[model samples]
Target chain A: MKQIFRTIAMIFVLCLAASPSFSQTGKTETYPPIDSDALEQFGGPEGVRNWVESLFYYIMLDNRINHVFREFGNIERQIYLNTQLLQLVLGGNEVEYQGASMAAAHADLGITLTQFNAVVEAAYNACERIQLTYEACNLMIAGLAPYKHAIVTR
Target chain B: MEEAKRAKFPVSKGAALVVAMLASGLSQAGWYDSGKVLATGGVSMIDGAGGGGITPWATITGYGTKEGINGDLHYTYAPLANYTLHSLGAAVGFWDRFELSYTSSALTTGSTFDTVGLVADTLGGVTGSLAGTPINTGIEPFNTTIEMESIGAKVRVFGEAIYDSDNLIPQIAIGGFYKNNKNEDLLKTLKADKAKDWEAYISATKIFFPINTLINITARYTAANQTGLVGFGGPDGSDKEIRPEISLAYLLRKDTVIGIEWAQHGDNLEGESVEIAGLDLTGLQPTLEALGLGNVSGTLTQHESDWYDVFVAFFPNKNLSITMAYAMLGNITITPDQHGFYMSLQASF
Candidate 1:
């Protein structure tokens, strides 16, 4: 038994000794870069900012309604509503109509800088045809919707 | 006087067998002190063979480490046809580096025909031969039951020897444990005393995260002193053994791990013949002295084995975990073939 244990120990030591070389040499794959320049031309900073403002207002409105009426409290429902609103406003050049109200509401809710950047990214994709439609907007809204609860609770 | 000498040898032989078996079994089982307290930055749970280091990785699972303290309460239960054993233990850490623990267990071996059979004839002979009634005619129904209890305390000390940026750290630890057992009627019948055993051990674990999702390997070794249950025989016969262990763990998720380990123990040592101090007229002594020729007092000599274990652990949150393990005993000499499976849940506050 002692001999067996010693052999097992030696095997483990050798494996431990060999691991570092494998780890050090293994190549780390990187992700494809996001094109910020192409993104800027689609909406410029102002257009992106306006789209973000609108999305925030929709999120806050949904949170208020869900807080008051337990049946509508689902975050997914809020995301659906935000998607529909973004579709109607961004269908053409209707950005000016909803931009100010959305921006004011988000600012009032104390949205953090990180969250604001996320909102801008989402809006830029929505307007530049990257997202291109209400269904796409809804997907983005659903993805960002969970963050609303986190922000509010924090 | 002849009977007294005869009795001495068998008792001594049995004691020798027990010592040899225990030393061999434990060494194979990789007996050791899990150096490092509950708060120390090492493995948090003890494995099936009563050893430590269940695959070390860079990510810390429990609250115990070199800088803080952690404590836990655990229970184990195993039931067989004639006996049932239960153990409850508690461990605590000091300054995240040193650990102290205590465990108490109760073993209840139900009524036995062998013990009853021995008493019936011995008692019948004592009474009938004096009264001139045949001993067999005087025999009557006899009942025998046995219960055993054991308690142990352990302490472990551990620290890091090398630390690197890749999260690989080499650490070593030393620990000691003392165990005491009480058996109600068995000791009295065998003319033996309670059992006491002490063990000290040292081990090292070096964690290498050569791969992001795997903990390459961990190894350990331990040595301990055997306990003699047969009383007044040979200076309290003790044996020493060496055991080495190795294990590998792969992370299924950040909070879950799976691993397997193998360990083996060295042979038992032959020691000097024990003195049967006060008992008189027993035929057991000479038989024992004859077998003492090859014994060594403090080192390993004969009878050893090896064991294998597979285990899994789940960490649902930062302060709680559950583990399951199975072990197979191999090359046993005096004891029956044994297999054990265990499940344990631990939480710290």
Candidate 2:
């Protein structure tokens, strides 16, 4: 009987250990700042494309490609993609192109440019809160260099 | 060992009971309202319209300016010389955004001996055999009865079509139903081969409104595949069938609609011998068995019946509506004409 009790207790312990917990954890993680030096390196229209490519890679690593593409059930991802796209363009050279306005460009692409701008500002503010590094800022800048004109012109 | 093997997966009697409850529940609920009398209509909801109401139509209608959720209730009854059928269904929706539904049906079919004396005489044939009489005994009366129930959930992927902003866009919906047919015990009692099967269906709807208030139309097609009915046949040799329907609704008021619909099943059309590679039968028996009915066989022929419904709906608010409808079956092969009436009240946030 004692052995049977021990066996039942062990089985109960194993079952409890295998169960998944549904409680929420209170700890929150902060994101790093934008890489401004990389932004400067990739400044201007020539830098915009590279910046978009880097942002694309970051988003992919983050498992947010569908959000960027505006596919099914990715509204939050779409906002993030639009914001990053705008930050790369505005943060680059101040040359303006003769296409649609940034807002219109975003609209044409099935997103709201105002929303994108808001997201960019929020991201920048968040970076300050975390005291982001200059290297990180520069990396983001460099990535934006390739499509600077496309961003500003739109 | 054989009994143990049978017990291991012996068709779940509990699951069968649950299915029976669901089937009866849905049929009695009667909430889905299809809009057309015989054809399909464009898929869209004008403030009280429901998805079940959308029938197939050739032209696009009800593009834009149509919004609202519609709820429906439906029931069907068939009384045949050999069997009886009772079905109930109910459905609710929100701005055509989401839908939840349930249906249940009970069928009592096969031969019933009205007199005990006749049954005793039939039994006497067996006793006579013991007496060494060479008289041939006639076959005893055999009958089959079946009951099935199912539940489903659906969502609208898109609200409006891209190219035609005025029309209700195509909606993609997916749902599954659990059916329980009660004839398995009868099949076992008769020592006949049978199995209980599950069935599923998927469909799309497009609604069109031409000339605004005068005519609203919709077209819809559904495909169903299922298996497992004791004594009749198994899923291995079951066939799939498509149902197409059309509906037309006339707007009596901004918040009111009156419509008619016609629907047909492709599996058991008139005059078609209901048989598969490994099974043989005539009409409703095989179809019901394919649909998860165990031992229920009826006088109804396979696919020999079509359905018609007339319905009215009233919407008092954006999220609430009430509907009333009546349906009848025509060209029935084995039953007295079937008739049904239903009323449903629904709300969604």
Candidate 3:
């Protein structure tokens, strides 16, 4: 019994180890066409605006990244640009984000991964405040997850 | 900007409390950052390794990021049908790259000794009547505990488990544990070759974000019998071999997850023949079998089974987590199908 188990286990381990051994390198500047379903879940562009506003409130309250936001200044402009970007990402083709690219925007911010995750947490709490479905929140998180590489310069 | 400072956020008290407790108070020290996302740092495994209930993964133990440190303490209790297992441990993660851990584990074998005593009495009666001489198997029925201490270390080799979400490559790590059993005399009676040994393993863990699923695979090489509680190696089949463990977890929510794991064990004492005070019992196997008592060698043979568990973990906040599981630990020495409920509580800082 031991020999048989060893043989089967060895085969299984070898297969898992051999597959997908290479890392995903490089980056893409293009975003996928807006997810209309997700936009609908967020109740279109107006709902997205409210969600971003709620997110700003949490961000200011969060001690981890609030100081960075305070240092950046221009709270109103930050909210406008973020709302537009979120709308476009959630499939609102009616508006275009006239802001800097994610990497360029945060390049000089010295933002650490910890601070980046803090922003994500703030966004999650905002979703809960707005009563977004669990699936909707996950979709939003998955949509925003890839931006971590560009934003976390530190 | 000044207006934003007085924005009246109206956030939940729970959120405020978690943020105040986890993010504040330690920034000046530049340590205990608790920077990792919630649930990213897994709970401590049975052997104090950072992973699930029984299997270790590639992820580090605490919420520390690459620039900071974090640590936690855990206690686990598992009561099987014939025995109970208890473990308490502490682990510290250094910059989320390296980990050091220590665990003390105990197994209560009081009930198991009753069955062992029965076997010894039956074997002694048969041998004494057949050979016209009394033989002592040296099996005592007294209740005693098997205790062990382990020190473990792990280093993440490459890849990222939580970040780099757009990848198929998993985070890989290498680790080892040095375990020493406290019961030296009991192990010698059980014919264990050694009381202490080291085990090594390589683990690969990946999180598939789209599915909210995590898969971790580990291959461990060791000769420790029953995870070194009963001792290392043995007089029977003592060979250090690679055993595979796998875990699959699905994130039910951001702070909740359910998972299952399977870990194989080395059967180091299978087919061992009994010896009573330097007297070989192989010659009595046929007679014992004819008497409907089975082979005499079988009395001493130990067959171990793989371990499996289905567990659910809830992260109430970053600082605390509670995990409950149904653990199926197949056989411990002569006991069969030793399975029961297991639970663990961990507090991180």
Candidate 4:
């Protein structure tokens, strides 16, 4: 019994010892801190293009939202159009898109809040995968989170 | 031997009042809520409880988000060098308050005894049929598998492990498993104190949404020998030991998680040749010396080690989940680091 306690105590100590190094690396921020604005920090339309491309790749691999990505035909064109729309929203180009409302586009798909969360999570992971800075990734997540009400129907 | 007295955890008056009110008012409620998110119920553990592959956490089973009753049926197949394990079990959660589970495990040690020459080794010169001496009597060819059953129950005290990221408070649960091993004759011969033993545990789980990860830790006190596969506390003295286990999973998708788990096992079986080949032998040395098997040792399982696995769980939908894992059963008994494949199919509603 004492041996077991000793072993458990040893493990506790090890866990405590290892925890601080991670916190020190300073990735603990939930969202990135913005200096000027999201698009300016993202380096304009081309930068947003790479981020959207990587984000879409992760979403396509995610089982929960992948169906929605595939069901939309001409994925490459759709991706191009969406990126353009994002640029327009983030003050990039004066592009015009007769896009479907988020509600109308997803109302038939029965997207749950959980699925929307997964999409958001994928965006976060994609930010890291694309080597976005702490502030840039956080900004993207913050920007995308507002669309949950539009994207989730169920 | 019986397990130690159950550990007690304090239930705050407010929490107790809430549980009592719900139980009294919500008995036999129909069509439960899908508790938590998808695949958040966690995959079934080896003991048939809800959690990771080998450790049971605080998560309730099913999609019953916290209001209705949910049940799960699962079957797991694991192949190892010495034995193959097949477990079939089911678990049910009521109003996300209490959980009950049961699983039957079959471990086939086929030719495992042969590998150690256990049955063929000289058996104290008893007048037996084969070779005019009793066989090792451990287990012969066809009857290689040992069958055991486990019944488990857990109660969620408070908090949310997966969904609630607002507070630092983790979800806490207290649970116990009652195990009955069927091979009483084998257990008796091995000097196990009892054919039945139990394990009691308290688990805490928390989700760090910022990191997209969930971590659970369970501290278990158990008297079962070799997790009750070989029976309970042996002649080595009937005492329980605390074992700690942890499972950490990262959500790659809301419906998919990839994780690693670590669990340690205790050697509850008493050793006979405390020194022989490291088997902790008690008193069978002289007879073995006469048989030219003096160098052989560890007649019963003596040393124990930790188990680890890297696994991925995928949920195609809310009701179905599949888990695939590669396990490292490090230095269990006489084996080196043995590696194996584990797969389980779970249906929950």
Candidate 5:
């Protein structure tokens, strides 16, 4: 049994050592460039600001993730940044996100998967409450999907 | 007694480390010493630290990591008709980079020892002889408690399982466990590996944030057959096999999750002939047949069953959580169609 196990381990180690293709795991994913039409569907800059407020409202009440924002009062800047970021990502040239990158913004916050997922969930729920068309909501979520890696630092 | 004390030294050290981390962590507060997001650190697995029932994943076990430290303690119970398993576990995660964990399990095997003729083995008789009657080792009616301990460590190598919404790069982690069981003498007669064994694994996890879906895959390689449940090694030789496990979870709420976990295992105890744990049943076949029991062909040694558990985990707060799962044990080797329920309570910081 020991000999057989050794042989198997040897094969495994060799496979890992010899397989260069296995190193492709750390690369980032890319999505198609956002178009202006989808941004319009997400409801322009003012609509996005309202949507941000709605999402944060849900986030404040969410038990799973509310603790993270307990001390982060005064989210006016956050709202502004999010609105501009959403507009820019949705193919609108009306606003530009001038804040730090997502990774930098959340690096010290030590965001967790559950918190991240809650944020996404709240965003979706807010979209629902806003009565955006189902397709448009789906599009909005897809548009925000790519920022998870950057926003989640922990 | 001295050896036992010596054996506990490392665990004590680990505990001390946890205490020290906690002490220092308490000095600075208000930023949420728990560090990472709430409920992001999953509850513990049966034999290791991770999500799912039997499989471990790349994610660490707490909300800390990126900033602080995470610690948790858990207890689990699983009961079947012939067996009951009770386990206790503890884990500590630092910076989300590394984790150290320990788990101990006590399993009561009912009416199994007597049927296997432990008395005969103790009295220097043949492998299965008690008062001149060949003991039916395959089917038993005696109960005995078996104890096993496992210590594990894991580290996340690169990438992340969650939060990397745009990254195809799945979170990967490397981990291993050292397990020791007290049933050494009987296992020795069966040509098993040893009283202790090691298993190594690599896991990858990915979370697609938009869909709120998390998928995890893990591959493990080990020589301990049946996860060392039916004993390890066999007469035919024990070979390590790479087993794969997959887990999928849906976020019903931010704090509530329901998931399905499936883990594949290998059988390494087929051995040669009808030797049931070194007690060859060939000699008793005719005798049993004459008694109207038919030739009890003892070919039940190689039964390895995959474990499937559908679990629901709810975390009302970051520090407290509970998991309830229904596990399908498939084939229990000595028994047939053994399934059971599992519930675990976990507290984390």
Candidate 6:
């Protein structure tokens, strides 16, 4: 019917309108452009540190991916570096991430898709626990999504 | 900020305690692991498949990861203007790759038998009067519940519908369902060729994270009449034909989605003349026509229509999901524009 087609067309247009806002930060060689509002809600690098710590806390408790985390030598250093990387991901220049490239760092882990999904779930839970806005959490996940190919070897 | 940190300190300590337990070998890994993401296991479909209300998708039916198993039970009900449909089923997902399901559906035909009896009585009266004899052709009311059972299986051939958001390739799967209608005598009276048949379909599903949209397309090959509730094939031994079904959904968040689905059906039973029990209408047509009562041949030709719905699904957690929809099932049997509200409840583990 004409009404059904019109409704479908309207939804398609809305999807198109929302595409650019979520995809603008794709595949950047360096840190993405800072979103000042998101950074303010994050309460700067201190807030970023708290969120990373919360994320690692959940990661260590998750049986699916916790064993992989146990293989790391220094849990505190891993948390510190992840906080710096997350800060850069949110467009903050407060710290530089000194860890290896995502592919190289994860190459030896033999992580499966299941484990990667578990990690993503944990990250989302951490964002929620930190009381981040819904859009901010989605934007953060979108920024990190491209690395799945590199991190998930199987 | 200080208060927040203080509140989270116990959580941090608990994590450390759990890690210490793991270090001391005090924990045993559980057998079942619901590691898949939320809402990734889609809601249970009407036919017990894991998909939208009517069209099946490529995703498996539960929250299990590749290393474990998961299953769920679902109940769906639709109350249309002329009839009501009830479906109940269960499904199991194996290693997140293969799925098996069973569903039993019943359709209650309201006011259909009375209308048939009224037509039969009038024809009998006219023909008997012309022949100088009184005849009775009234049919007794019978059980009007048409029941069908479906057993289905699906295997994921390739691709991933979720978690591979970096690519454009969608998940693809192939599946089939064997259906059996329980009303054998009624099917014979209705001039159907068979009471059971097979329906096979291949589905492709993809989620575009950038737009927060999910799309599923399926091509089904079947000879079923109104999804086999009325029976299968026609009086002419109808061959299986291909039809298309599609579902498009937009994610409001990770746990909720609003969507639309359209499923096309076949017309295998259309234009077929029917034979009512204890009535030979072919012999009475001439007598009725001679009395100027018009031709009284029982030409029971019914047309079927495509089914579509607009739905919203919400998953409060990984264990339970609820879906509500406005369904449009046009021209079912003798009824026109059979539209109504549909609701389904699913519990997954």
What is the DockQ for all candidates, taken in turn? 0.03, 0.01, 0.20, 0.06, 0.17, 0.15
Tens digits of lDDT, candidate 3, A20-41: 3221121111122223477788
Among all candidates shown, the one with the greatest TM-score: 3
TM-score of each: 0.44, 0.39, 0.80, 0.64, 0.73, 0.75
lDDT of 2 at A86: 43
Provide the clashing-pair count of each candidate structure: 33, 112, 0, 20, 11, 0
Residue A18 of model 3, lDDT score? 56
lDDT of 6 by residue, B1-349 (tens): 7334533344334334423432332122453546788888999998888999998899988887776667778899999887799998777777789887778898887675554555555655654566656433223465377788777789987776764454545688889877777777667656667877778898989876545678999999988888787787876686888999999998887788999999998786665544554454455557446755344344344668889999999999998999999999987765678899999999886
Residue B249 error, candidate 4, Å: 1.0
Candidate 3 wrongly placed segments (more than 4 Å): A1-36, A87-95, B1-28, B118-140, B188-191, B271-301
Can you rank all candidates by DockQ, best first?
3, 5, 6, 4, 1, 2
Note the Cα lDDT for every prediction shown. 0.37, 0.38, 0.75, 0.66, 0.67, 0.74
Candidate 6 or 3, higher TM-score: 3
Each candidate's chain A: what TM-score?
0.27, 0.28, 0.76, 0.68, 0.74, 0.74
Model 1, B1-349: lDDT tens digits are 7334533443334334433533443354232222221212223433211232232222222244333444455555544333344555555543335545445555443442333234334534554466665423111243332322222223333323222212233444445444444442333233332344444445554432222122222232223211222211122333444455565554444355667766654333222211112221123334323434122211111122455657676766545666676755432221234456745566543
Model 3: per-residue Cα lDDT over B228-255, one tens digit each: 8878888854578999999999888889
**Ten contiguous residues with the weakest lDDT in model 4 chain B:** B6-15
Off by over 4 Å in 4: A1-154, B1-29, B115-121, B124-138, B189-191, B270-282, B298-301
Candidates 1 and 3, the one with greater lDDT: 3
CA shift at A36, candidate 1, in angstroms?
30
Q: Give the per-residue lDDT of model 2 (tens digit) for B1-349.
A: 7334433542344335434543443365333222211112222221112333323222222111113333444444445444455556554443335544445555565553212123224334543456654322112344445555434445544322211212233343433334444555433322223333333333344332221122323322222211122222323343434455555565454456677866653332334322322223333354445545434333323333555767776766434555566756543333445465645444422
* Highest lDDT scorer: 3
Summarize candidate 2's per-residue lDDT along A1-154 as a digit string, tens digits: 4884476457546644653321112101111222334444334444444344444444444332335444433545444554444443334333323333444443444432222322333333333334443234323322332222233232
What proportion of the true contacts does each candidate reproduce? 0.00, 0.00, 0.21, 0.01, 0.15, 0.20
